[model samples]
Target: MSRILAIDYGTKRTGIAVTDELQIIASGLTTVNTKDLLQFLKDYIKNESVELFLVGEPKQMDNSASESEVHILPFITTLEKVFPKIPIQRVDERFTSKMAFQTMIDSGLKKNQRKNKALIDEISATLILQSYLYSK
Candidate 1:
């Protein structure tokens, strides 16, 4: 079976996560520069069968689209043009960053390790993927 991929898109960096071929267990894949994300996905798809793309949809406390959506919407448009075969879905991403930080604290990561924005992004992506899996 093909795996599901999730993305936590940020202005400067993007977090990636994927489920196993059996569609069980979401795991952090990596953090990549936003500019390189398309190429990275192209390369990844060459090696893995991706069934769908789950993108984090940033929203404010009031459930309005967050400012980041301005950037994400364009990226989603391009992603559709590039990978028309794969379906894309949006998962609510409110408080993901804060949750990621708390997860790091619970994991007992040191202050320096917790300060790694890339790691937090990666974890956030994993959380998004896990949430999607649970929803299904």
Candidate 2:
């Protein structure tokens, strides 16, 4: 079976994560500039077997769609246009960035390393994927 892919989309960067072919064990894949994401995915799908695309859905405390929609909707539209075959889903991303930062600190990441927003983004994507896996 093909693996599942997840994305944490940000204005500046986008994080990617993937599950194994057996659909177990989500892992952080990479973070790329938002502008480069489509091309990056095109290159990535060429080399990997991905069946599902999970995108982080940011929301406010009251469960309303946050201001992130301006960017996210466009990205989702682009994904649908570019990868029509893959099914896309959204997972709640509340507190993911905070969780990612806390996880890095708990894991003893150095201050310099923790400053890597790309790394944080990737971890957030991983967290989103893991959350979905756990829910299932």
Candidate 3:
């Protein structure tokens, strides 16, 4: 099977993750500037056989869509347009940031390393992808 790519969209930077070729294990890929995200995907897809785009869907405690959804919707539209063949799926992303931070601490990251927001984003994307994989 082709790889499945996960995206944790942010206004400043976007986190990326991908499954192995067997679609079994998900791993953190990289973080890219939001402005350069499309180009990054374009370049990535040229070399990788991505079958789907798994995107994080942010929600609030009330279960309503989060305000950040506004920013994400446009990016989703762009994804549909640019990668017309690859389908996109959304997974609930509530508390992923907190979870990522906790994972960093659990993994023995130092205070300085834990301060890296980009790393948090990448881990969040990995969590999203892993969640999807297990759900299947």
In model 2, pairs of residues that clash are none
TM-score of candidate 1 relative to the true fold: 0.99
Per-residue alpha-carbon lDDT of candidate 2 for residues 75-121, written as tens digits (9 for 90 to 100): 89989999999999999999999999999999999999999999999
lDDT of 2 at 1: 95
Where is model 3 more than 4 Å wrong at Cα? none
lDDT score at residue 19, model 1, on the 0-100 scale:
100
**Weakest 10 consecutive residues, lDDT, candidate 2?**
69-78
Q: Candidate 3: global Cα-lDDT?
A: 0.97
Alpha-carbon lDDT, every model: 0.98, 0.95, 0.97
Candidate 1 regions with alpha-carbon error over 4 angstroms: none
For model 1, give the 10-residue run with minimal summed lDDT. Answer: 59-68
